[model samples]
Target chain A: MMTRTFLVALIGLSMGSFGWADNPNKPDDNTTPPSAETSVSPLPTITGGLVFNSTFTPGTQSYSPVVNPIVLVPLGNRFLFESEYNVNSDLTRDHGAWNPRQLNREIEYMQLDYMVNPHLTIVVGRVFTPFGIYIERYHPEWIRDLQVAPIIFGISHQQSMGAELRGAVHLNSKVDLTYTGFYAFNSTINYFTGDRGLGGRTSLFFPEKGVEAGFSYNRRLGDNRFNLYAFDGTWNMKSIPLDLRTEVFKTGMLGNGYWVEGAYRLNKHSHNSFLRKSQVVLRGEQYFTPSAADMAMTSMSGMMMGDNFLPDQNTTRGFAGWNYWVSDAVKLSFAFGRSFALGENQNIYSLGITYRFATGGSEK
Target chain B: MKSTLAIAFLTSLLMAVPAAAGNPSKTPHSHEIDGEAAYKANCTRCHIAIHTYSARSERTMISHMRVRANLTKDEADAIFQYMAGEQKPKAAPTHTAKGAAIP
Candidate 1:
């Protein structure tokens, strides 16, 4: 607890250096040098949402509560302070007497963004790892189609601590290129451990068609040869309310997998009731577990390769679901999945509800 | 300087209480959102702000966004116009192409 307190105090001290809170309405701080571009801006706002998921498989039931919050604080014209908090809980009940409940609360990301120019923005602190489209796009429960994450999403290097340079350049009206490259140092403060690595992702986005495909690669500094790569594609049809997304990932030693998912809105601009605000989702995936020898050779390898998650065997999973919009902020989703493996096949079912809300950021 | 910092910290802490406990908005129904509001909700979360594109660029970008974000044609147009610096909604243009997705 003391450690947490100290960390909070440290954050306070850092914010004070920017003088954002002290003089929230002060004219640009020009008297002394400023860490970021100076601006007299509105109060930094808070945004995020609460998500809850429940899953049932045979005799067991699990309820997961996810509270993810994001804070956006603009320090000045050039610098912005942003932080995301993730607090999760799992309540489980089994026929057996021993049921373990787990709670994890950590800072998912906190960073300062410096807009160097139209072509680049510099970031310092912990930032989301630009591995695949999922990490940056669909990982948030509020934005995802289904309640349960893909099996392959477990090993995604979610975040890193260090500096990143990212931005986009529009070559012409028809096409634009976006890029992110970073070098992060390894550190552990509290429950969160930063992955020290060097890597970047580059993608060409078609702004007019609402489609972009890109590739990502990362190498851990600890082990030079420990590399990961991902290729992703996204398409949103302009004629119809349909979106298709696919990603292929290969982690040097953690194994490899690919998943394709699609979401379709039933009706657009129609005055119908439920059908107007409804959406259907479908997903299929294949994963190949790393060889035992490969797992043993890698640094993040775990003991017992074939125990669960099909460490050795090839596995295929398919899921289908639907989402109903109760209101703008609240929605209901139900999904069912079947895992095909060598031995006993398992079925998974999930029903989840998510609510989203935000404050401030009303400025132009 | 120290006093200013303290006040700032206290003020931020106080502001957080309401946001954490209270609802800023309900899930926004289509009618509840407008061109600017829809643009803010859809575009701001990912990038800091929308980049200014020419009318043609905006139309294409909106077409892609319409599919990706599951936006109606009107919603996409609003965003396009917003990026084109059109704050107020206007009547449909009469010269739209026969098969153009944007009205």
Candidate 2:
């Protein structure tokens, strides 16, 4: 019932946006033809990518094929609706024959944005939680340089059903201040679940130097009352094709960790050469968890949980990977890494291919 | 101890680089803005490939990106002109009101 109500509300809002665009009070003259530089009518566009990955571990191997599709509908000059869905299947083998494929499908984010001005925008509906930069910017399969997530990826909630206010202000000619504040309501609905919380992030960006640093904070308000804090930074070299990023996060004594990654695109070679199409990436991460005895003494006792995404014990990992751009929209990648944990050491190998596509766009 | 020192060293290195490198000139004269250079500087931070859309779609997209990327009005206008192929090598002022009215 709640899901149905949310859907209806979403539809109503979208229709109202279109009506607002067509209102006669708008400033633009309707009879005048659009210039060659503009479009006569706003058109929706579809853009996303497909990824197929195979990973081999010490005694287990898994294959995953994922399709992530994004739809963008421009209601008018000020309103835009965008949504992304992730559909994937996982097939794994644990020493024996391959197991049955497990299918998973979920909506990553579905939101409507109203651009109020250059310094403020209002967003509503399900959106990526405004915590760290990784979840919002680099979690996409095609955009991420490494296939595997960092050790600290699980520290914060990935999505929230709420309203967000975000914008950027030019502090001066060289620095820009970007800020986001949001409130997410608690929901138990499948695929749309979120803990009741409020959070905000602020960053200072230097466009010419391609450098940025930010801090984030979140406080859960319900039964799981806790706070999460994070600091992230990125540097993109203007003289060379190099990028460096790092993130450190802690979640209320549950765990703490950090990851640093760097990628260098070999663009100095000839355009057609293989070396020119290749990018090299390196990453190192470490995770630390409190001992069982230490956790039992706190109010969070019995809340400790284990998952495939988060390490069960303290662990350190190092990875090296290469990506080859088959074309402007296709890429092939391979990576090898080692995980050092308390119980044992494991070697992990991954290979993947990604293709990004967009339709309803004018050819360049 | 070694890892701690390494991390500290890296953090300092990231912060210590001279901020003047590759600083674009702030000339007031109307001139041709290199759309490709502007696009590479701003858009390539997150996007791996350049996806072309209709001029109208590009306008909306750039408006959305201006807010998401915290781009300056001039920077957004420059990127829009480049992506939409509106004015190729034409002399234009930097503060033209072609895109969204951000006041």
Candidate 3:
């Protein structure tokens, strides 16, 4: 507790030096100096809100309490403050038709960010490890999609004593480049511990009119540490009301996988009105993973070796989903997903809702 | 009569130009997304914002999705392609001199 207090104080002191909370509205201090003009303009601001998630089972019904509350504060154009609190209860059993429960309270995310600039930012304290896209954004009540995260990337929700730095730069108005780098010193909120992994990514963009494309790579260390690479592209229709996005990714074990997603606006005139952005998404994927033993050993090696981690069998998937934006900040999604395996198949049905505060930027 | 017909044909072509220009698919452009929206909708569940911003890998991300979704190679490829295409390339990072660090 004392250590946590001291750390918070230290962060506050640093913010004060930059005149964040004390004089954020002061124009001169808030704006970047001409010599350091690469920063994202408009500086930073503080915002807060609350969100909750609940689940239901076949025979039993469950409701998660209003658990999560978040606060975000910006220091100058370089530092950001983030805190998340959760105190939800789990219902274990019932007595005489009454619900008996175990309630838990914890901090999910709390950290301080020091932006060296728009191209570089560092974070310390309890933080999240950049593992995979789904794991990084798995909260059902907070996500716009209905699917769950994959098991790779360790599947943990939080990490402590973590640090990371990431940013991007514009080569010109039509093209830009971005990168991310990170390290976690300890376990997550659930107390899982293991060796830390290193990750690097580079992406390019062409925002001239309508067509766009991007590519990226990532690597890590662990029992099953691995590498990944991908290429993606999108096109917006002119004469009709349609948009298209497609992507492909390859990994040591899964070989390569791909999907195409498109959303058409029911009403295009009002900039795809929040209520009229209702659309359908269709996706498909394929991969190969070696037998369990080979996977375990390859993961243990920590060396980047291709062809060694291929799965013994092949896995395939096909899914179609529906998504609607009730409002810009509130979204609803439903998906009927199916998986095909060794002469067998499985199916899943999912429903989800999400609400995001008005903080802006590409959190990707 | 011939001159009048040519003028009418040219006007028709001009009208088509705006229609073609308005198409996001036909044109090549960059998309500036609401970072918070992208994070909350897609990235906030398994990992939080700070973790994602730290630079996780495309392989790691795709592998996780494949395993979780039990996706086929084609399906996985499509998703990967879509995501990679959406990324905007950024400038290469430059660090300060080693001596700049505090002892």
Candidate 4:
């Protein structure tokens, strides 16, 4: 409790010191030397989201509260420093009593980026592995359309400590080519560990059509020598407020899987207020193991060897969910899913709420 | 089964082209680019809320998005203009850093 209070107080003090609560209409601070040519640099800002979830399964119930915070500091016109952290706790019902688990704190990424030009940026330090669109773009609790992760998520290396080159180039009037290439070093340091690997991702984005498709390739080096390949795509319909996304991945020996999801917001087509605030989402996925022996091998190797949270046999799952936007920053969500394994079928239910917040930005 | 899945995926990709092509109305004219349209096109995939930030912070945020979202320079600039309310007149040509007119 004292640690939580201290953390809250520290955040509050930081926000106050940065003038995050200042009125945007107020005049600039008058104490500075009023040199007309001296420009006002942007202040560092904090932005992120908090989520609370309650889930029920056949014989157990669990609750998770998570806070993900991101900080961005602009160094100059062309350089910026950014970092993100995830603090979460899980409480589960065991023997009819709630058992609280230890808090899990993780550093998502900490990196410095230099925008060299319109088409290239240099990034160094710890960064999310550029494998598929999910980990980098939709992993955040507040942003994901569904509450649960895809089946293929275990194959992705969550983060890497290394250097990366990323940028976008205009291919023509309506198309753009975006790419990222990186090399990560092996590390065992606490909170900053990563397998040595090299990988790259490339995509063609049709801005006019609101569609993007990409492929990623990663080659792991060392004792766990293997190659991982992934393909992902996203499309936002121009004719309606609908989104379609899909990902397919294959990791050598361990397993292969695919998931496709669709979400539709009713706002664009509805005049009723409640309907306008509502969204419906559906997702389907399948995972296949090479064999029972491979499954046994994977389970024995543990999470670091890509056996985290996966079933011991082939599985297929389908989910349907609804989300209501209480406000732009707050949301309420519910989902029901069913999964089929070798000889068993299970039902999963989840209810959650998420609140997103930002500070040290302009007070619009 | 794998072959069927691959074929279905390819068919969906193929279907998207026509569907996209049919919606010519959403495309901005060659002479003028709409900042709000560009913003909606590029930035609304993950979330829908648009937070206001100081000019400097706004630029930094958009730059960050440019990297994360893989937005082209023109799209980023257009979004910046729209968010900042600094959009040029419809008749005016928005020039890139190279002084080339954006299509």
Greater-DockQ candidate between 1 and 2: 2
Clashing pairs for predicted structure model 4, backbone only: A362-B53, A362-B54
Residues A1-364, candidate 1: write the lDDT tens digits: 3223334543443344333222335443211222121112324555566888999887778898888887766555446677878898888888644377888787878887764432345578887777777776677676778887776676563678876655544444455455666666778776446756666676777745767888887765554346778998988666776778888988857788999998877756455777765778999998887777777776444322211233366789899999876655567899999988789478989999887655542223
Q: What DockQ would you assign to candidate 3? A: 0.03
Docking class of 2: incorrect
Per-prediction DockQ comes to: 0.03, 0.14, 0.03, 0.14
Candidate 3 local lDDT, B1-103, one digit each (tens)? 4323322332233223223322334322213333232222222122211211111233233322332222222222333333334532221111101000000
Candidate 4: tens digits of C-alpha lDDT, residues A1-364: 3223333433443333233222335443211122221244556777778999888888789898988888888887568898989888889996588786869898888999876544556688889888888876887777888878787777674788876667665555688667776667788898887877666677898877989999987766545556678999999887777889999988755688889999988776667777777889999999987555544544345334321366567899999999887766677899999999977788999999988776754344
Full-model lDDT, candidate 1: 0.59
How far is B46's C-alpha from truth in model 1 (Å)?
Answer: 9.0
What lDDT tens digits, residue by residue, belong to model 2 across residues A1-364?
3323334443443343343232345543121223344443446767778999999998899999999988888887667888888899999998978898899888888889886543445689888788788875677777889988787776653778887666555555567667776667888798777766666677888877989999887765556566778999999887777889999888745678899999987766446467766789999999988556545543443233211256668999999999887766777899999999987799999999988776666544
Which regions of candidate 2 fall more than 4 Å away from where they truly are? Answer: A1-41, A270-272, A290-308, A362-364, B1-38, B67-74, B86-103
Where is model 3 chain A poorest over a 10-residue stretch in terms of lDDT?
A: A30-39
For candidate 3, please provide the TM-score of chain A on its own.
Answer: 0.61
- State the lDDT at A301 in candidate 3: 37
Model 4 gets an lDDT of 0.68
Of the two candidates 1 and 3, the one with more favorable lDDT, higher being better, is 1
Model 3 residue A342 CA deviation (Å) reads: 2.8
Which candidate leads the pack in DockQ? 4
In model 4, the runs with Cα more than 4 Å from the true position are A1-40, A292-308, B1-34, B86-103
